[model samples]
Target: MPIKAQMEQLQRVTSLSVALEWVTGCPDLAGRDTVLKLIGEEVSTTIQGVIYSAESKGGGGAEMA
Candidate 1:
């Protein structure tokens, strides 16, 4: 499947702990901090993308005063 399709599939999935476990099992990381940092960055980027898309489509809610 294409990356877009894979991402859409991921969006439909809700078991984050399972996903986190799979990601952390990758051999290339070789360290806890590296896995943690990469996960943190990816999560931050995903959240930012969601926020940006929502704002661009005028679906984002108003900020509190």
Candidate 2:
């Protein structure tokens, strides 16, 4: 399949975790670097959100005024 079709299929069928796994396992996949970079950013953002939520609840962060 062409790159566009592969991407559309992924969007239609895979969740984020599954997509990441598929992309990692497919070394020859087109746009693999771009996909990995995007996935990394997504995971980083999710982690940041969780950290911020925890800190807001007094789990350890800057003092809340």
Candidate 3:
């Protein structure tokens, strides 16, 4: 599945193992951790994009304003 679709599906699942199963089709713990970490980094980057965009639009935090 596409990464975005996988992420959306994973977001709906409760258990990490279940999410990983959907991601990789196996119960590979180490690989799952790595994938999860990558997902986290991607999420962090996306959040940063939003924050930067907001700052550029003069909608950032109190300190910036």
C-alpha lDDT score of every prediction, in listed order:
0.58, 0.64, 0.58
Error at 10, model 2, angstroms:
20
The TM-score of predicted model 2 comes to: 0.56
> Candidate 3, residues 8-65: lDDT per residue as tens digits?
5445443544555566764787886788887666666655655565566565544554
lDDT digits (tens) for residues 1-65 of candidate 2: 34464455445444666778788777666689889888777766655665566576665756744
RMSD of each: 6.7, 12.1, 8.3
lDDT of 1 by residue, 1-65 (tens): 34474466457343443567777677776675676676667666665665565465564535412
lDDT for residue 25 in candidate 1, whole number 0-100: 71
Candidate 1, residue 62: CA error in Å? 2.5
> TM-score for model 1?
0.51
* Estimated TM-score for each candidate: 0.51, 0.56, 0.52
Question: Which residue segments of model 2 deviate by more than 4 Å?
Answer: 1-15, 27-30, 59-65
Error (Å) of candidate 1 at residue 59 is: 6.4
The better candidate by TM-score, 2 or 3, is: 2
Q: Which ranking of candidates, highest lDDT first?
A: 2, 3, 1
